[model samples]
Target chain A: MPDAGSRTASIGLEGGRAVTARPTAGAPRSVRATAARIAGDWLPAVPLLILAVLLLVLPTAVVVLQSFRGETGGITLANWAETLSRKSDRRAIATSLELGALVGTISLLIGAPLAWAISRALPAARTAWLSLLNVGANFGGIGLAFAYTAVLGTYGMVTLALQRLGLPFTPPPSTSFTGLAMAYFYTNIPLFILLTLPAMHTVRDDWMEAAEVCSATRFQFWRHVGIPILTPFLLAGWVLIFTWTVGIYGLAYALAGSAPAAPVRLMTLQIGIALNQSANGQQRAAVMAAILLIIATVSLVTYRIILRRATRWFS
Target chain B: MVFVGRLGRGALFAALAIYLLLPLSAVLLSSFATTWTANPLPDGYTLASWGEALANPRLQAAVARTFGLAAAVLVLDILLVVPAVYWQRVRNPRIRVVTELCAAIPFVLPFIVIAFGILKLTGFAIPSLLGTPPLLLLGHAAIAFPFLYWSVDGAMAAANVVKLNEAAQMCGATPLQTLRHIIVPNIGPGLATGGMLVFATSFGEFALVQVLVGARFENVSLYSLDLLTRTSADFGTLAVLTVLTFIVLFVISTGVVWSNRGKRGTAVAGARAMTAEKDA
Candidate 1:
């Protein structure tokens, strides 16, 4: 959404007639005029442009570039082939997909009801719930792994207590696939709730009132009205958590070491392996990362599309 | 019907509370426990873990540096994000769609990928500053940019910055003066909200540190991760550090989030406004 006028103004001024007439006056006057033009017309966009370029666009370009180039400085697709052909790589991919799907579905089931309940609660309760969700969302990545370990690790309090009670099931350590999924489950639920809470309100109290006046029970109301209205939002939130979990590296890494000791089946760990393996490892990582990004970007685009449609009814 | 609804709601909230709080209570108890075995409660409690963990001078220094970096990231976020958000809200609706996409990038763009990108960029471009705190400062700033933007974007609307800006302009204030004196002070709560978000993000970030900087520099997250992975990782010390980190994050966020007088969590306030249609 670049402002066409401001863009043209800056470009035109920098290369326009007045400046061209004194082409050799490349001193403070020219610089200040250019500076003033930017400051006056597009000051706000400057920082964002610099950040987007340096952090995202440039790095992505480098990765994409590296992914396509061979070690001999020649262009090739062998990196892509190798990255996808490896059995371990395929395993990582399947694991990420499985984890994302399972976590996404489970979180939606738990979070949707909670989000609705919190949305319909009083202001104070809503505030408390939202605050708790905010903290949980922030408490992800490494700290999340530790929290899970604290209660679910081999010698953890929960595991120990369960053993004491003879529950017939020992909670796995945070370093296992089950443990990673459980930790992610904790994280995704709050995120789903937070993102979907606004959509829950989109159900509108008056709509509920109208439905009830028409001789509807709560189940009938939700089945016909609430579920219909919230479906797109639920789907949107689902994909978001899925894409998020697929690329989640930190929580997985912190919970399970990058080595095979813990055997966390994640594509990110493959990237980590590539980081440590050999000189050409980064190339493989670049390819795998590109592949992961493709999955995430496609899913995210779907999420945005659904989110747009869901919010279309608002206002 | 009403009774059933109450029962279901009560069960939902109760389960939620347990799910969220149980893990944290484990960490809390371990931080104070002398021994934890197959017992539901700690056999005995002592301040030894806390005392020993905090007594390490290096750990103390790490805490200071990590918090300092967090503060730096917060400042950088304020400087970088405020203008972009203000620009989007007040001046240019043309950029809203673009910035919003940018805002959503980190969600799908894994930080591990971003870390590798940064490592390549910094190590290739500026070999000297590779793996330094400055690299992290820049990375965290960019990473946390969207969070700050989200919060401030909400605040800008709640403060009605456009109207306020116009009113100040009519009263003979320059744009700079208007932003500095009028708009900023008005969005004070928003800045604090954004600050809390940016601070937590910077402080707790693990992947960037683990990947880009690694053992060369250790933040709280790195410290905990390192301790856990170390062959002789001390559980007592680990518990103390984990609890300490969570408490720091929890208390600061609770204070800020609550002190907003629960302005409906300005952090997500923009979600509603997202579909509210831009008045600007």
Candidate 2:
């Protein structure tokens, strides 16, 4: 919580009054004051700010600028045109969105119930389980992709077990667009669980008890009370997952190799591969535009919706 | 009566346990299977494959490089994140928004954007990122920043930071002294948790290292990837590494979470005791 006095002090100091008030014309008061302020705040960020801007900001600006230009220094929409011209490119974008949506939905389905169970479970076990869930959720991408490949690969034990049970196990064709989506969903379960856990905790037990005392059916309670309160949070979590998967290149690259792995392939994997080719600069630019456009739309829409709902908390 | 509840709970735990453990078990089994090339199940169990992997210098180098990068990023994340978050807590809405926008840049933007941005700016003018420890650290830090920032911010939000700072200030402590003596000690658990997450991320990261750092410096994940792709697969080494990583991450996460819970418990107890004292 903001301290009342600190708030007052910070507020009072605004417009140069709080910081440097001519220092009574004393020797080194201005310098000491400035040094004190800098030491208090800016010192910690100096190295990080320098590194982040150099390592992150500069390259991003260059890519965006380069994407809008031709090799001959002409600005053109030709790259955008080229990216859209290909059926494969369109399909790639479609697959990525589909994967993100499916993963978000399924993970939510699995995660929400699990989160509820954990919240109600014994405290120590709950803590232990949540920690495990955290690790699992964060453990995916490249490392987990390979682990899945080993488990579900052509000679994977799951397939072996299914075969022994007289069930036809076709090894689930690991190289297709569909397979990649399935892998993403499988790995994403823990992530959704972890993200949604915080929201579940925020729903205090007393609120649930109140609903239960009123004889609210599980579905009715969830619908009328839980859903309204938790909807913004769920949406926020979903959007976060979607944004993450949209930019995910590791799983796409590792699992599907060089194949056009659908929508994700177009935006991330294909972009990387396209960049490697000398003649596909325009195509790469077009793909980048499309990817950025998708990200901007999703993020902006989610931000607006969440921001509106978020104001209720402030009020 | 408790028997039924215990049994029911046990069954529930078993199901969840199986779901989580099965994949890991499968991987570990394959890691030791000698004839993975010939049979669906490992034809023979042996440590030979693991020995070979460990013997290779590349794997060792990569593991070293990965840890080194993780350490660097931990420092960087704290340095950038603390001030930015503190200012976010202190500044006007507009300044807060701008700083938050800066902090959130990595989350919204993909890795390629970040990587490409870095590369284009520093292309050959400075040394290449290829095999450079700092460059690898930067890539990992970019990915790890959002996690560190969010977790630390959550902890800061929960703590009564301004009150503590003001109390210290009233006690005649300088700003630096207050932050060092009061703030840092209280927020220790958060910093530790964030650091652990950053460590785990960099240690396990495969993509950035492979793309930017390459095989020149191999972390365990990259090494595992290479082993998987080898014509003669080495499951034993992969097994050992997986088990070790799982154990290390489990310990770090549990430790951080436990410490945070302990601090929270103390805070609650202290508050309650103070209330009681006032009543008396």
Backbone-clash count (model 1): 0
| Model 1 stretches with alpha carbons more than 4 Å out | A1-39, A123-135, A259-262, A276-280, B1-4, B87-98, B170-172, B259-280
Q: Where is model 2 more than 4 Å wrong at Cα?
A: A1-44, A258-266, A275-286, A293-297, A300-304, A307-315, B1-13, B36-41, B83-95, B124-131, B151-182, B230-232, B262-280
Query: What value of lDDT does candidate 2 attain over all alpha carbons?
Result: 0.61
Give one digit per residue, the lDDT tens place, for model 1 in B230-261.
Answer: 78877788778777787788777776656566
Query: Relative to the unseen true structure, what is the C-alpha lDDT of residue B217 in candidate 1, on a scale of 0 to 100?
Result: 82
TM-score of 2: 0.81
**TM-scores of all candidate predictions against the true structure:** 0.88, 0.81
- Error (Å) of candidate 1 at residue B164 is 3.6
lDDT of 1 at A144: 71
True lDDT of residue A279, candidate 2: 47
Per-model CA lDDT versus the true structure: 0.73, 0.61
Candidate 1: deviation at residue B2, Å?
A: 13
In candidate 2, what are the lDDT values of residues B150-222, reduced to their tens digit? 5565566556566676677789987668767877677776777777877876776655665565666777776
Best candidate (score: DockQ): 1
